[model samples]
Target: MGAQVFRAFRNFNLENRAEREISKMKPSPAPRHPSTHSLLGEQLRHHPEIKGEIASKNDKLLALLKDVYVDSKDPVTPVQVKDAETRQEPKEFRLPVGHHFDMMDIKNIPKGKISIVEALTLLNNHKLYPETWTAKKIAQEYHLELNDVNSLLKYFVTFEVKIFPPEDKKAIQSK
Candidate 1:
């Protein structure tokens, strides 16, 4: 019984509040687009001479276009283009053949950097004769930074594998 009375009072209050809000709001005016003729008239009134000047320029442009159509007596030549591959210089003249680096092989090589062949040769030389191929000597010969050569000698090395027979070769396996 109490719930029904509360619901009825809430509905009545909501209806009255909605009616008051509706009465306070004013009706907004509808949007209306101006006709094309009226818009044209307004533009003409603001700039009376623009239309005549535009018409004259348009006639001049048309006359220039007509002149282009009338002047085509010269022969049109097709351009001969050489192949892209033939025109461009090769990036690498010679591919590396072996693990050795020859002085003649590096004629076209850029400065301050060694090729893979050169790097391997340096590493092999360092491993075989450390006194001869010291970091300073390698850096001077290869045109590389001393610090970089030091780091390369410190971090990189050529692997050497050594295998030994089992302690008891007669026995097939050891437990």
Candidate 2:
């Protein structure tokens, strides 16, 4: 009877140990692979059409960045203000109201002729009465012949002026 009881107790202990080990074993994690769509479920929780929406949004973002960030190497010049009382109009050129000439002393012109730098300076400082000047208007204001203005524009191009290619064409055509 004692031997029978010892055998039964040993079997019971073995069964309990097996049950404990089975409970302790963790379930295998879900397989990770590109073909499996399970991992993307978390990211796509809010958006039903996430892939298509992401691609479209990416294209728009790229276009916006391109439009906002144009490539230009030229430095921008700050506008200067002059005292109204001290402003002098050039003898050869009529100063438009509220516009003053920069380096307008013709006597100091290096070659007795206005250089391209001088011409551009004059245009930059010229108080544009209408807020802008057409090429012909600029030529007339500076006492420059059409051809002379064209030559000056060409010189400015060589010196890396910030004018756009279309503006340059218009200036040349106006000559």
Best by TM-score: 1
Tens digit of per-residue lDDT, candidate 2, span 1-175:
9999999988877978998999896989887886566668766876768877766657777888878956777654443333544576664424332234543443333222455555656555443342465556656655567776665554543233465557446555443
- Those runs of model 2 whose alpha carbons end farther than 4 Å from true positions after fitting are 1-112, 115-117, 123-131, 157-175
The true-versus-predicted C-alpha distance at residue 141 of model 1, in Å, is 0.4
**Distance (Å) between predicted and true CA of 86, model 1?**
31
TM-score for all models, in order of appearance = 0.38, 0.23
lDDT for each residue of candidate 1 in 55-95, tens digit (9 for 90 to 100): 76577878888788555566644433335335765554333
Question: Which pairs clash in model 2?
Answer: 99-127
